[model samples]
Target: MSTFSLDTATVLAAGDASEHRVLIISLFVAFVLATLGITIWAGRQTKDATDFYAGGRSFTGFQNGLAISGDYMSAASFLGIAGAIALFGYDGFLYSIGFLVAWLIALLLVAEPLRNSGRFTMGDVLAFRMRQRPVRTAAGVSTIVVSIFYLLAQMAGAGALVALLLGISSEAGKIAIVILVGIVMILYVAIGGMKGTTWVQMIKAVLLIAGTLLITALVMFKFNWNISSLLGAAAENSGKGAAFLEPGLKYGVDSMTKIDFISLGLALVLGTAGLPHILIRFYTVPTARVARKSVNWAIGIIGGFYLMTIALGFGAAALLKQETIIESNAAGNTAAPLLAQEIGGGAGSAGGAILLAIISAVAFATILAVVAGLTLASSSSFAHDLYVNVIRKGNASEKEEVRAARWSTVGIGGAAIFLGVFARDLNVAFLVALAFAVAASANLPTILYSLFWKRFTTQGALWSIYGGLASSVLLVLFSPVVSGAPSAMFPGVDFQWFPLSNPGLISIPLGFLLGWVGTLVSKEQPNIDKYAELEVRSLTGTHAH
Candidate 1:
């Protein structure tokens, strides 16, 4: 799932792809070498738990904003969405809208308060006004679960992408790529820590945006810079013709599909705020105001990038043949690259190879940056929340905690690699949707209750996290994602009884209800004094740790 745009081995293995292969490999190596150099440099500066987990809380708003943009834009958004748009027209833009709108929740409500209250992880903010051990433990567990789901998705995608880029057809070669990605990401966290990860993310963000803007400009140029002409050409080129420009071609306007679309929307909009890796970005900045500023910068950058996806997607549809896109990758993930290949000057041309190489390289860099952030967040939760507070009763030294974090990086990375190799054939986008459902259900409700509701108890926080997690997992297991339909991971097994694929429609409400019920039924009184302090600090950043 390692933020890959396409499972392109089949594409590379297609007719006369030797030139494209060499160009992709050469550029990928150059980018990897440059990123490895940065990781080595950041390793020397990461000395303490604070430095490792939060980049010493020193990054400026704009810098962190760039990092956030890098982390948020995944291969799914870049490759998958663009491909979807190329194939399905307007239907693909829904994903872009969901991703961009999610940041609004983060910027307006979550960023400032999270920065004011949290010290290391989301658990810090959750356990801020509650019983320390139980609340922290629940938050830690939820964080790890969500992070692992995302990590596996990213790693699996990485394996597929690497196999394609390197033209490796064997399972062994794919596994090697998975392990290579795992090792690099583990080192990114264990060595460079957050500072290194942040720098990598910032660099990747710039390159990704530049590449996207360039391709978009190229797309418009193909149509003589006339918006209507591009639209008309795309509509005419798409096999669906007028139907392609309309919604419901891919997702459908049926009742069940409509509900599924709404559920997916809910998860995406709420999930970004709850994502541990994204939330941890706030800790990298120095103050609540800075966090707010970073998020604003992120929204602007992300919004523009998504808008460009329109040009990329439509450009692909207009310029390339649908049969050709399907031949390259049934998932349409290779649409952007193929589009680049054609727009640059067709397959064997120097310009085509160069443009295709740039896109592939940026895609790889995007994966590396994102996985490093995920590894750091998961490891931080393990060491800071579970090992320090729960196991050691908060008595562990800073050095011990940092050491534990580094070791946990290895553990988490290994698990991710193992899962990625096994799940390489799974749908990366579907897996990510599941992760979002879990995060939105498990983490978002707890954060909102913890930060805004005075009556929220430790028991309530625990209920919210566990309830959300359990329901999402259970629903996903029974849903079409795991069992029913030809696309399901286990299509032969028909245990799916749930009507919808996404669990957010059911699980998110259950989480909020459980929190309310757990709080009302509690015999213990609310901690008014602690709530007063948390309320003041969350709102005004007064006397914050």
Candidate 2:
């Protein structure tokens, strides 16, 4: 193992940055071209709505599982979580735990049932036992909202990650990167659809897991394979001493922070099952058994990856100065890449350039794959759920619906680019946690009620979805995330009053309560026959498409 020195790791000056820029740029270009070529190939085979929306249910269990990992493991996991751990220590590792453990919820509660019930979107499942138009509209609205929030995290991550690699620190430069990423993401969805997107995600997952493992192994090797030694070095390098190993660096500070941690935990744990992109991934497989198998595979892959994050996060702390990491990107999104640079051979060395380029290329792949998935999810919701069912009243041709989805991708991509410029300063992982909170609040309760509650009515679905959606969004709008703090999206203002950064604590329960109460107050009786059929379809897959 190469000896790691703080002096060597911290010397990536302008001269060295310029040296590494060409290699990094080349890798990024190669990755984009390769993925784009795959998309074009997949697009040629996409001959129908089924192909565009669900990849014609063509992927196997292991294949879909790989794609799921690709879709789920965002820059938030690779860049955001590593930065969090490198800076905040124990509190930051909590993100990985929350994200990995979330799959249990998806596996046990959602995967099989969702696959058995839904044809193309979450709207299909929720509208199964309710008034089709109203429920589909609500579900479509919720899907798009949740999806856009998730996309912002990807955009923010891409901007920060790419900005660091290119040595661009200006606001305008980062904004330009965001727009470029958005444009490329739109092309991925518009051209490749689900088939192309899935293939990209699958390839990205392998690269990410392999890249992370390399860093993790090197990190462990640096400390002579001693876990205690690695932690001690990290703590010493962080200048926080023993406190770094304990809680409260960022999250467990006091009563309010502890409560915020709980809210964040709730969002992370409950959010995965309700996430539109993840939920729709379940429909890409051929059977409910395959869906369950895919979740099983994802759990193994994601869980192992999270376990490695312990090393990647702490490794950065052990190797690089806190100030250096903070200076590169205040939110610490660049920690993993810097860590790779150090472990390979810091700064002006040839080894450093190659490793940094590889890790960064993998990270860029993560951002592109995730943004494409989120765009497809939102656009699919609009075209399949809102446009066809609501506006066209199911009279539109398949070709028209698919065409509308392609156009929707362009609009959504533009919106993400505009908002991403403003959110460029926040931590990508934290932003994703907020997206999770919204999904858990708005989508989870309604999904659960529709699946298991026989008494669930159309009013209850709307109240649960819309009420939860509006409340979580409104709370976030006034929360510290958007205003009232130096780290907020709008730092100059001070309008925040909400205590928790994540609204999951209050909004999740509120969604469930509204669903229950709305069911009780509704005059329309529950459709027992439809519920029975849905229940059977969900449980046994007797007649599931």
Candidate 3:
């Protein structure tokens, strides 16, 4: 079940690797301290609800753009997608395509309207034209569920990535790393608030882009800047010949596999627009125009980064043996770092150690920044939508609401840590794909309907949120990811009956269907006046919060 094979005694016994371990540890410690300092600095500027939840709406387009990229280019992007390409060949690059194309949906449909309509969380926009209590409650629940799923992937990635680099092969070591990540993320959300978290994300984004750029350059140099050469070598080294460079190696093998590929594609492409953490990021900017710019910048930056992943993935496949990559981490989460080590100068070289340390630190920073954003989004929903808007009927003071959000951060962080330990062996990309499916299913329907549909009612919002949430999670519970397969979280169990590992194809349409049905059947009438006001506000930022 463990991806890491280096235990404490083993590290001590391997005298040469000890130096590499020391270097990695030092870089990790430095990144952590540097990010903490940034958080502490930003925390002082966080004074009230607006500051805590939305960074006082102070960031410019490019700045918030980096933060958004930081949040989006997570372990799934860096580790998971790269690993998928390394292991599955052409099928894996599909993730890169899906993820990059996802931003178009965000830019065209989500970013501006969301920024103009909502003050803080997604619940704000969803509840704008509906019964506040019921809609806010449902939106809050949906947000937390989606955010937690996303958080679990980041935490699981953190555990596997860190343990793989530090040479801690024990299960306990991985669990401990998860706990440490949760604790750090809690501090980022609770103390630094949105401002601190944004700053950390921005810094992490720069580091991640730099690290990836360096590796990509090295990879291209190794292949003499020829894409053809790299692909040929990868195909040869993958042990599957030309098949490795083509489809069906991973997702095109059977009817079920094809459907699963489509499901995963739907999740990755449609999921970005609905992701709670990514949604909340728009609030950090000043205006709807700025939000659009943020998305544009993010698209360019993220697109470039993913394009580099082609080199990273293929380079790893070309250089490292498939069996060794699997032995490093069956999910291939460690392939990026191993590639860095190799390109720097194989295994025992000083250059390899330095490069590994740098790359691992960048990835660790990626994990920390993403988990912070997710924790912030879920906790903000718990406090802003559920506690303040629903339970207190908007009677709570800003200070009290902020306190509730901090507490919620601690609670959600703990849950993520607990869940991450169980999920450490799972593919981070696959786990995140589930989160995307849930978000697309539960949140996206309500959001699009609320913004564009004149007949969208409170009942429709409720049905879409709850129905989508329930079906997605339930389907995943019975899917191959949780049981009935060798890679299942519980490999010994076999209760899975769902065919697709990802629920996007089924759940996403169901969410949209349920919303339309609920609206038609409900007695509650749609509010024309509120819808008009919402439209004006969403389109022009007229009297927006």
Candidate 4:
């Protein structure tokens, strides 16, 4: 560890009256009550498994669009990206661009077909044209893995936010947040189902965008619209400076680090279109056309949010100063909140405090909304893909399936909470990238090939899912993330076998290649003519549903 003599004790000593504590607690309580109220309301009208899982398939395009944005822009986008920009300069903005560009993939390739064919989960699409057991089993496993990683990221972000806002230990804050999230999400999904989750997402998205834009405008006002000057000043003050702007050599390490950064970027961009939690949201819309339109709206909203993050990051770099930030041990992650206080005025300054409060509240809400969505996705996979299809022999009633789904939601939420509490300090951005990589590696190939490739066989889907998942997980285990190989968790390990921080560069292609090769080797072919016709109709909104 590089030693810096910034006294964290002194920084923590400079305390303000805990006036914000009450406000924060009140906000949390309000969110819980509101979510519960919505669940109760949705319960009275719940008609069947479809209503519980897909909001009765009556959501308008715009409403679904906002919900999609809400689901996509989790704590990772709002807090993680903003912090990354504040700390890393232009490199952070590059991440924003990568995230935004993924929507183009969603719009052009995944959205319409996905919405048209699937019912509750991606398995619906994959199994629509193939054997149910193999496809459902593969998709369910992928969904669980991806959801766990994504949940860990959100939980980590929530822990950091809670610690910063409430003046508590990160460990304690992490536990509190995990428990809070688990309870709220379980209730939301178990009671309100999809409708409750959609409304919650919509409300949280509005608050998040408004909060980010408001903070961004204030920061710009502080600089008087001098964008060039702001960049210059931030570059000069930033510890990394020009290196940060250009993404030089990954901390003067080596060519391997550079490759790792590039691989990570690719994973993030490609992974968004394939994430089960995100892909399932597309199916909630009424039509493929609606799905297409929603993508456009989500793109615009998300793009705007990311643009504001660039300002927030630059504002933190220029105004917060590295010495002060480091002294607090806040590093890149704390930049946004610290900058907010500075620009808004001071710790107790009304404008700054209020803005900080809103941002914190939204961050909390963002985690809740996302975990709710994730739990629902995982639960549906268990109920629709696994339970009803396999154990129940596809003979279960809709009510029975819905009940199983509710119970599954509780089980998944509990597991995530347990993991989040244990793995509290893992980097949120890193976990998110891993989640994306796994999804792209394990899930995307099967879905895409089964839909578009004529030679896709059930054996191929099974081989691809297992092979891709194994490759990604194994590569990640050996990656710098776990072993401190290339980048030592501590200074003396020096055991890196591969240079890239992320495994997607290799794992994604390995997945696709394995699937194709498996198809060639398998003699059996799927009779998917009718399935393909249905998919085309779904994509074109000619389905008679």
Please list the Cα RMSD from the true structure of every candidate, rounded to 1 decimal place. Answer: 1.8, 4.2, 3.2, 4.0
lDDT of each: 0.85, 0.84, 0.85, 0.74
C-alpha TM-score for every candidate: 0.97, 0.93, 0.94, 0.91
Residue pairs of candidate 2 with colliding backbone atoms: none
The TM-score leader among the candidates is: 1
Model 1, TM vs. native: 0.97
Preferred candidate (lDDT higher): 2 or 4:
2
Candidate 3: which stretches are off by over 4 Å? 1-17, 163-176, 421-431
Show where candidate 4 strays beyond 4 Å.
1-19, 167-177, 239-253, 329-331, 425-430, 485-496
The TM-score that candidate 3 achieves is 0.94
* Candidate 4 lDDT over residue span 302-407, tens digit each: 8898888878888888887777765554435456667767787778787666656666687788878887788888888999999999788699999899999989
Candidate 2 per-residue lDDT, tens place, 442-462, comes to: 798888888999999999999
Against the true structure, candidate 4 has what lDDT?
A: 0.74
Segments of candidate 2 deviating more than 4 angstroms: 1-15, 167-176, 421-431
lDDT string, candidate 3, 313-344, tens digits: 99999999998878766767667878888898
